[model samples]
Target: MKKSILVVEDQSSQRKIMVEALQKAGYVIFQAGDVQQAIDLINQQKPDVLVADMHLPNGDGGDVIREARQLPGAPVAVVAVSIDLAILNQNLTATYQADAYLSKPFHPRELLKIVEELVGVSH
Candidate 1:
């Protein structure tokens, strides 16, 4: 089965970019623009991977990451993305229990690589 990914980003363009990139890489993609929507999707879909922007409209990506991690069944690998240098510099993987972290304006290939590593898939 194809691995599924949930992308939580507030900016429409940024979310689109991530969705398209992950879709092209052959993963099933789900997207949400805020924390509530992301959390809703997480409970419903239980995606294999989660790529979340640190800043969001309602709450933040950390909320979404926590929700995913708390879900039962297979564990979800979380990737936290942000433009904030301070947040990026800090160990978000430890702080948020994320599987990885990516800085904003990152190449799609970088996102793909992280997702692949988290999901144990190659493309």
Candidate 2:
């Protein structure tokens, strides 16, 4: 089965673009526009990987990453996405345990590669 991924981004256009790219790359994709929506999705189905934007409505992407780390089973591989990479912080991965970070204006291909690196296609 194709690995699943949850992409939490607030901007509609950017979220749609990234979702489309990941879908074309053969991933099972889930999308959330806000922190609550992301949390709801996670509660329903835990994806193999999480791609989260740093800024979000209701809560920040860090909330999702932190929660993902605490969930049952193997932890989710998290990729932090933000317009200001500085806000993501090097300590985020050490603290929250994210797998990767992607700056905004990043190439769609790079996002795919990062996700693939975290959760291989075979996974």
Candidate 3:
């Protein structure tokens, strides 16, 4: 089966772009605009990977990571995104147990590359 990915980003346009890129790469994509939406989707079915943005509307990436880690399919490969906050760097990988991360204003290819690495997807 094709691997599934959950993209938890608050920005509408950004989410659409990432989702499109991932779909082209042949991944089943799911997305959420806020913390509640993310949590709801995550509980229903765990995605093979989670790409979460740090600064969200209701909550941050930390909440998403922490919640995902507790799910049955735990230790879900996470790629946390932030807006050039050095502190977010330490938080994503360390505190939240994310496998990878990205800074905002980055190329879509970069995020896709990290997702590929995390899920072992080959072009």
Q: Report RMSD (Å) for each prediction in the order shown.
A: 1.1, 1.3, 1.6
- Find the candidate with the highest lDDT and give its number: 1
Which residue pairs does candidate 3 place in steric collision? none
For residues 10-80, write the lDDT of model 2, one tens digit per residue.
99999998999999999999999999999888878888899999899888988988887777998788998
Give Cα distance to truth, residue 23, candidate 1, Å.
0.6
lDDT value for model 1: 0.90
lDDT of 1 at 72: 98
Give each model a TM-score.
Answer: 0.96, 0.93, 0.92
lDDT of 1 by residue, 1-123 (tens): 899999999999988988998998899999999999999999999999999999999698889999999999989999999999898888887788888999988999999998988878763
Model 3, range 28-82, lDDT digits (tens) per residue? 9999999999988888878889899988998888898888888873458888888
> Which residue runs of candidate 3 sit more than 4 Å off their true CA positions?
none
TM-score of 2: 0.93
Q: lDDT per model, in order?
A: 0.90, 0.87, 0.85
Candidate 1, superposed: residue stretches over 4 Å from native: none
